[model samples]
Target chain A: MTTTAVDILGADDVSRAITRISHEIVERNPALDSVVIVGMQTGGTWIAKRLCESVNKIVEGANVPLGAIDISLYRDDYSLRPVVLSAPTDIPVDLTGRTVVLVDDVLFTGRTVRAALEALNDYGRPRAVQLAVMVDRGHRELPIRPDYVGKNIPTHFSDEVAVGPNGVTVSAVAT
Target chain B: MKHLLDTHDLSIDDIVNILDVADRMAEVNRRQVPKVPALKGKTIATVFFEDSTRTRLSFETAARRLSADVLTFLASSSSVNKGESLRDTIETLSAMGVQAFVVRHKSSGVPLQLSQWTDASVINAGDGWHQHPTQGLLDAYTITREFGTPTSLAGRTVAIVGDIKHSRVARSNIDLFTRLGARVVLVAPPSLLPSHVETWPVDVRSTMDDVIDNVDVVYLLRMQLERMQSASIPNLAEYTRLYALTPERAAVLQDHALLMHPGPMNRGVEITVDPADVAGSRILQQVTNGVSIRMAVLFTLLGGDSVSSLTAGGEA
Candidate 1:
């Protein structure tokens, strides 16, 4: 069963969005000495590393600590499916009192952000946590909202977004 | 993440999911380019404050297979000799961009504490005697692979014989086996049985011979001399005579019944039956499964998905 793919954001658009987000982050928190970019696993993680690179280029002497977090074990549905052996969560920097920018590809239900928060809490409490997403498809089930949104894409509950190193595409199927 | 905190964080389905992923990882182990670019630019810091070679090496192999660099920190050469706390070492490593932290500490909740202090993933290797989630998962996988179904443990009686009080393996096995539908019998001397055994969902037996003929599997646990602070038993020999799985006693079991052990076996102390001739011995299988199981765990926790799925009402 094949489905049609709709171009939501291209690679150039993503790079521009990330560049703008980096500026916004520095503007929002002028005292930010070092930024720790934690990707929300899978695609979000790749985006986070790229965003960190962009942010480093913009700010002098500002090197962002990067890490990838997996929240599979913390999922509420953990009991529903078989146990999934997850990859190693790699956060190569200390999170103690540092400004944490959680990056993701798409923010749909806000649950991923919530899980990232829970997973981050286990690591350490950050000075402040800012959420950065390439696409913020609004359908929040919780009170949580992103601190810096790249592009707010509105859609029905059934639609989904697939983001990779190539670009961001939207689909009707639930991914 | 470095530390494997607790088995309580894992559900029955979580255990099964990891086992399934491990099956796939096993295939990866056979390939020529066994290494994947999954954790290419990453590093896994394994800090074992306790004594363990099998679990440590298994974790190392799993990380290496994923192409993640490994930095092993044993207590011997570490600043731990200078009384540097685990927290200090973790913070130092965190500064160096150590991505994931696999920690095995003697304290029950040390991994959880470290998890709270670092940004890295905390994979509890084995904490105190509280839980060995990976060991439990691998054992479950071994059983499933042998039986041809994940839930084949159902209706089977698994008798866990030996140091139940001090064995993290036994504790994890009880949870996993029971979840897989096996009726678990924890056979050990009263002194070796934890006071909290009554709280667990398992039948307790003081004698191994009583349950020998009925069980489908005999699981022996090691008896650490460190645990016997004041000689809980009359002597090691007497203890072996009373509770060990002797060759003659093993012969009483059904021919199809298996024998298993989470090794670093204590030979004559825990089991009088030689490990070499134990017909159903899957101890080696458990070790082999450890790498694959760990690979599945690392990939699932870090690889293909978002952290969102872990939360309530997370994005699909």
Candidate 2:
């Protein structure tokens, strides 16, 4: 039997999920003056940009500043992991007194988020830090959960939840 | 993937990979904490058989920033003075569980020899006048930082002026610059030029004025006064007249051209004070880049984050 990938969220579904997330974020951060958003590098940065646009559209001219971070070096299992390729990590402003919302593409093991939190500590101590993810596939090894999630996909151990600009896909591992 | 003994071992892809990592490591320097745990639990040993100010300090600083344990061994004051051979000294350190060795020696090929004697990865800081791979890399990083990309140097001119025969920096830069597709012009007195320069892959010339106006970067090499008198170049005063980077020659450079020097500079001899301090000069920047490039090298060689462990074959 041939193995194939299946789309979990189509373009319209992805758009609706983002719109819902934007509304939730605006409602939680009403003043919109203290809240700042940052995207984890690679896939998360794209989603963060879209999320920023969606958030701005709701609170006209909020123009929330978005930053991107690559957490390659901050992971707890650094010696065990493979050589991590790095990207730009830019935080335009100090995170000290700001309410920070971290955006990521997928949340499975919760390890990446753990590393992101630790990495953020090097930058500054935030007033409050919240996590927003596009896809949450349940396999968390840590006591961590997303504060705001786009879609939750519960899948098998070997399955992959891939999120991109096109949408989201769930593919079984090729045996 | 084992040891970095020379630039000749590095392909264009390898060089780019290292520089990209260096770019990432540069961010750590700007961070409030200015450190990373990427190389934690690994041990690095620096063996300096020759005297150095920037190199030994830079390597140690890079290792500490990565959170790796650093052990520095100075051969002059260490076991090498008491009847121990180079092999014995390295083997003793290897027994202590060192994962990497950064060696600087007055004799050529010492790093290469150490690689054969130990399983640990060897980084050639400088081995006599043979090669200094990382200096070449930092210079490349400096260029890429200035021009926006290493490949942008394809048609750019880089003229290295001063004593050539005794400079490991010149040899490394020549090998690296030509590999990255830059036209390199070697300007030195006929007495100071290496005898075997005929086979080298750069334009061998005797005067700086002929090539000064056209080059994008002018890198001045430190004159080896120790090698003068015995070699063709007899003294510093005569050598200064033909090749010193003075205010007059620095003025002749194009507006966008950069000035560089591999330091421990013999000021007023090879380069005038003001010329070395010019706004276009990237001398100080190169020193900063040195620490980052070294961190990149250490991380790539020892930062055990395997691609297989995190990517395609990573088991959940």
Candidate 3:
């Protein structure tokens, strides 16, 4: 199989997007003390930590709880594909009556977000839940949507959008 | 990968994969809910043809925690007494859409036979003295976690004490520990040792005193009195004097050396000392880890498409 890779968002652009999203998080959720950030495992953990750091920097003496969740157990594709656990879920604080911001690297079919939502319930009942993603490649199979998106780059179903600390790249596999 | 009949069927990759997933399952066990939707709508039937308390409950708890329905079958209460064959029971359950079978039988190869007769995945909880793969995995998981090594026990040494011939746990652990790069020493009387012990990948010790102070782990096996059939030892007192994890021998162990026992420990026969008093004892941790390991097994067999792909190298 042949593939073509193109850089979608440069490193500087990705940084700017994270900074902007962090500001939006603080601005929208006035009660930053009650807000927690949880990253979807493997891909979104780094971004979640970065977002937490940026959020704390924007607010003095703010100690926002950060966690990482592996949603493999809650996914609906067990019969269709292999399911392997990625990382241990580490929710440091009870989410009851607090807001949760779920971070992920890419948002494509919205199925991962759905699984993340179910995974969150095992932690605690949060007052509200929100989604944050670096890339929204738009092929949603569910009624889920991201609250804060860094970039929305539409692509074909076969295109793969990968987000990393370096940047974001969209690989087009020959069909 | 499809059916976990024995530890001999697992590759290094498979063992590591199950241990890694068990870590995740351990975290789930620590959760506020202590449950997941991984195996929702999937049904698991535990068919115990032999007597067991811990293994049966552990599998049932693991299945429930994963949100999978459980069907409990005991030979004593079931139609087996009414002359129903094992094949009839397995086929009946298969027709009822059982996704997996956690089988424990007094006769060896019962799980393997069931696998041949059914389409559902067969997990051999314990089949006579043939194999208890989950016990092996949990024991390996316990040791690996204690040593703070996530993958292998490359240079670690384990001394398994007592009843090697009739111990399914011993058979499974030997396969698993060696596969994970651990040197195993079997400490048992010649009468209690397996007939083909020379073929096994382990060193043989006639007494615990020979290897008590050196090994990283001291594993005690239960004495199968029922299976003894004849006098395997002179007497229980002599057996305890030679093989039990007595306080004198326990005191000689290295400070970091671990004490382990597959449960229903014969208090005065195999381990005379109080497990709680032993500073390095992981007897309870082994029981706790059983749930996590079995959860990993159940989820691996029923909640995934293929074990090979799930355990394949690289980022999951």
Candidate 4:
């Protein structure tokens, strides 16, 4: 099988996606004070920072609490994959009675989001939990959907999608 | 990677990784609800052949916080009193689908021996005077936290004081501290020193006065009354005079120097000053860090996909 790499989204597209998602978040949730943004560790950390920055610009004086969670402990695939821990989970405030906006880099198997949901319960019960991702590549093993999506790029199961500050690239099998 | 038998099996990278995970576990422990579903379906059986207060409770608490089911097997209450063989007892627990075993025995290498009889991951809580790897890791973690960096102990010097011959804490820390690039100086009487001390990687000092002010950390070891079959020291008063962390010696310590004790401390024998009064004492922190370090060990052994691939029959 021959693999071909193609740039699915450019750097400008990535920036615009954040701006659009930030607007969508502000439009859907009127009470910005009750909203908190949490990024998944490693991959989602940078995107979450950017999302928080974009949301802050959309509404002046919107100080969203940015946090990060490492779901290595809460994963369902410890038996299937090597479970390596990442950065520490830092939830700055009591998450009870607050709407949590969970941000991630990519949405594929949805297993990581499942683990993230379980991890959130340990902090405090949130009023509502919403997921935001940079890329939704369409192979979800769980019944999880991203509320705010950057780009819905449908691809094969074997194809790989890499998200970065530069752009989103997909490596697919050549026809 | 599979079982935590001793510090010898842990490389500097493995030690650093465990400490890093321990930092995360520390975060979880600080939460309002200090629990995670990491090991919900998994069970950890703490099979202690000897008596304990903190080590057993610490391991159990670590497992419980991680949402792992804990089965406590006390040697006194169990069928072992009815002459059940070690193999039979282990087989019994292994039949119950235990994924991990935290074994503490009065004899050295019992956990290593037990790992052979079962496929479960074995953690050596304390085995005679051989090693206590988690304690080593926790002590290292405590120092790392004090210094404000994970690899900050690289240039620092640590002095291990009292009962070097029969102290598993000293044995383990000597390996762990030196591996993390800290110079360890062992302070004890000639009789209390191990027989083959020359082969070990450390500096030897006879009294605390020799290296009192120069060290970065002073780690006190408990004088195990039970382990002392023969009188290694002349008397408690003489031992205290010669080696105990008295007020004068404590005053001689640098302001930046930290005091650490693996607890249930022998106040008059090893540490004479009140730990509470000392500004640099980390005794209580050692107890607190033990939970996080054990959680790291338990999660590393049971929650990973690597252990399932490795044959448990090989040496740990």
Candidate 5:
């Protein structure tokens, strides 16, 4: 199946979105002294790092901890293929007392986000975790929902979203 | 993703997908920017209950290339030696924010148990003689790269020589080769070969010479002296005489046939062939392909792109 690329957010637009999301997070969670951003590998990770940078720029002296998470091994498909172990997670800052902003590129079936949540639990329990995504395209099979959404795009189940250096586009097929 | 507990966890499609990704990862090495920011800011913890230099180093290198942070926990230095439980150690690492865990244990199925205990992704580095899935993958990648796309090993005979009953590498390779259609022949002394070899899919031959000339590939397995209680055979000398891949015996193979070994070689005992022959043996290729194959796995699992995008990227 082939997916048609539908433009939802561009590089410039993503930057703006992050800036706005940062402000929203700080405003909503007033009690937190600092925030740590954890990306859910690949696109989520990139977005999380960018969001951390943006938040830092807005709030001076803000301790924006950044981390990347790889959930490959926790995947349900482990038995079905060759097992490749990637690098471990590195969260320089402690999650014990900090508000965690979990960042991802796209929110579709919510399986990845669910996996990310499970992965995060292993690290330690954070004071709170808020989900943020560049695109919330619906079709969630789980009860999970993103707290901060950059853009909401209606899509068919057959369609898939692609986020790259260029921009965000929806393809009818996953490609 | 549940941790890959054993080869039984993988289907044919999973194997093919990993190989395909490994093929792409091989190309990454040739790029100006070998580092992919894909895993930037992620953490991967390597919890090795066994002493492994190659496997540990390879996993560390793979994670760094993808820009992920890594923590290496050696069993010797850790509480594991002080009677610290595996579950306790893993749970502690999990609490430390380790997203992925690369584990190696002396006991088989330790990774399986760890998978159930924590939320972190678990990759089995080695678990007793149960399985070494990544080793099998890299071997397959090496063979495919050397001999062209492994269409089917139907006519191809693979002679696996060495400690058959003790080497997890042998067990994993046997499974992978057989699934890809290769007829596997286990070459070992009666002492080394398990008594129930007949139950396995491959043929078991006590005489190395019987299958030496007929096989298309001779995969030499390392003799894990550490694992053996008393010598399974009389001694290393007798074992070498009967099972070692000596230079003289290697000459009997067809000119087109290849030799393979998963390293940490036993020198004169398991292989009478010179270590330099490993250049021609495709052992080093297996090592190099290891990084590429692992990268493929890391990216495929963490890329976050849809299946269609991955296909498009593959085509591109």
Candidate 6:
């Protein structure tokens, strides 16, 4: 099956989705002071920054700490997938009792999120974890769900979605 | 990345790749919380057929911090004490399915032999007067970290001084440093120099002071007084006066130059305490970087990641 690449969303949609995600986050945890935002490296990093900025602008006293995690080490499929290189996992704030809003670009097999959760456990116990994603490509092999999602772009099992600062694109071998 | 038996197996690209991945591994050591889940389900066997204070402990710590289950075998108390051959011990452990074996043997080529005996990766911790690949790797990683560039050593000079005949660290470093594009030199007494010094990819000098002022890094190898027993070196004072890094020699180092040592030093003999304790000394840093380098080695070999992937993340 030859697959193809196509632009799915533009910058405006991403920006709007993040703003909505920011609102949902603030409403879920009323004060927003105890919520910590963490981005998955290389992709979730930028979106998490934008989300944190939006979250700060919505509430007074503004400061919500941020950190980044490299879930490559926590991955379960080292025997199956091309491994991602290790990056500095800088968790700036203590996660104990703080609400961690885990951020990522695309929510697919739920494996990445699963790895992220396992990685975070090494840091410390969080009050709770709520996943936020810019795109939900909906073929989750694991029974996992994102609490705040920007757009739901259902895709073929073979296609891959890549979310960047400017926009999002889905690609697969051209069939 | 698979079975780091020696630095000779590494190309410039392979050497640089190990350093780049080591950059990420080094972060785990420096993190506020010193642990990672990189090798969570993996089992690592540290088989030391020789006495070791640092390499054995460092490998065990590195494995543990990465969350890997560790099984240690010391030759003195193990079945090897009961007359079992090295092959028997290894095959016994391989039977239990360790993903990797960090082997340090008194004889050269044991790591290579063990690698042949099992599918598990074999890391040469220290094998006779052969290769100590991880030591070479951590040293490169330390230098790369200090300079903030992996390729910056291309034109630099690194002098490995003392005990060239008996030091495996010297052998591995020469292979690694030269591959990373550094000019290497060996400085030791005539009796202490290796038999094949002319064949190695480095210059040889009768004394360190001859080229001491020109090098970017002055790497000192521990003077194996134990091995010098049958050699012609008469006394410790003679060895010190000729090769020991004294306070005066330390002052002559080029600006920004570093001093590195693979530890368990004969302090007053090969190097004085003052020179070793200098501001830019990379001795302690080498020890700390050991864990991360080994972590990268174990991960790349067993993670099903192609060895080429070691060069993937860091742009430099």
Q: Pick by lDDT: which candidate is best?
A: 3
lDDT of 5 by residue, A1-175 (tens): 4556668778888778888998997788776466788887667877888788777777777766788776553454333334444544556665776778898888887776776776666556777889999888887878998899999888777666787646788777544
Quote the positional error of residue B291 for candidate 5 in Å: 1.4
Error of 2 at A118 (Å): 1.4
TM-score of 6: 0.92
- Predicted candidate 4 versus true structure: per-residue lDDT over B47-101, tens digit per residue: 9999997999999999999999999999999999999999999999999999999
Candidate 4, position A134, lDDT: 94
TM-score, cand. 1 vs. native: 0.63
Model 6: colliding residue pairs: A2-A173, A2-A174, A2-A175, A3-A173, A3-A174, A3-A175
lDDT, model 3: 0.91
TM-scores of the candidates are 0.63, 0.95, 0.95, 0.95, 0.63, 0.92
Question: Per-prediction DockQ, in order?
Answer: 0.04, 0.52, 0.48, 0.46, 0.02, 0.35
Instruction: Evaluate model 4: give its TM-score.
Output: 0.95
List TM-score (chain A only) for every prediction.
0.89, 0.94, 0.98, 0.96, 0.87, 0.94
Candidate achieving the largest DockQ: 2
Candidates' RMSD to native: 16.0, 2.0, 2.7, 4.0, 13.7, 3.7
True lDDT of residue B12, candidate 4? 81
DockQ for model 5? 0.02
Model 2 fnat value: 0.53
lDDT of candidate 4 at residue B293, scale 0 to 100: 96
Q: What is the lDDT for A173 in model 5?
A: 58
* RMSD (Cα, Å) of model 5: 13.7
Query: lDDT by residue for model 3 over A31-115, one digit each (tens)?
Result: 9999999999989999999999999999999989899998999987787676767877889999999999999998888888888
B1-316 per-residue lDDT for model 6 (tens digits): 5688988887777777767777777777776577877787889999998999799999899888888999999998888878999888989999998989999998999999989998888999999999898998888888877887776478888988888888899988888888777899898888878887898889888887898788889999888778657865888898899888888888888878999989887778888857545776888878888888987777777766444433311111
Model 1 regions more than 4 Å off: A1-175, B1-4, B305-316
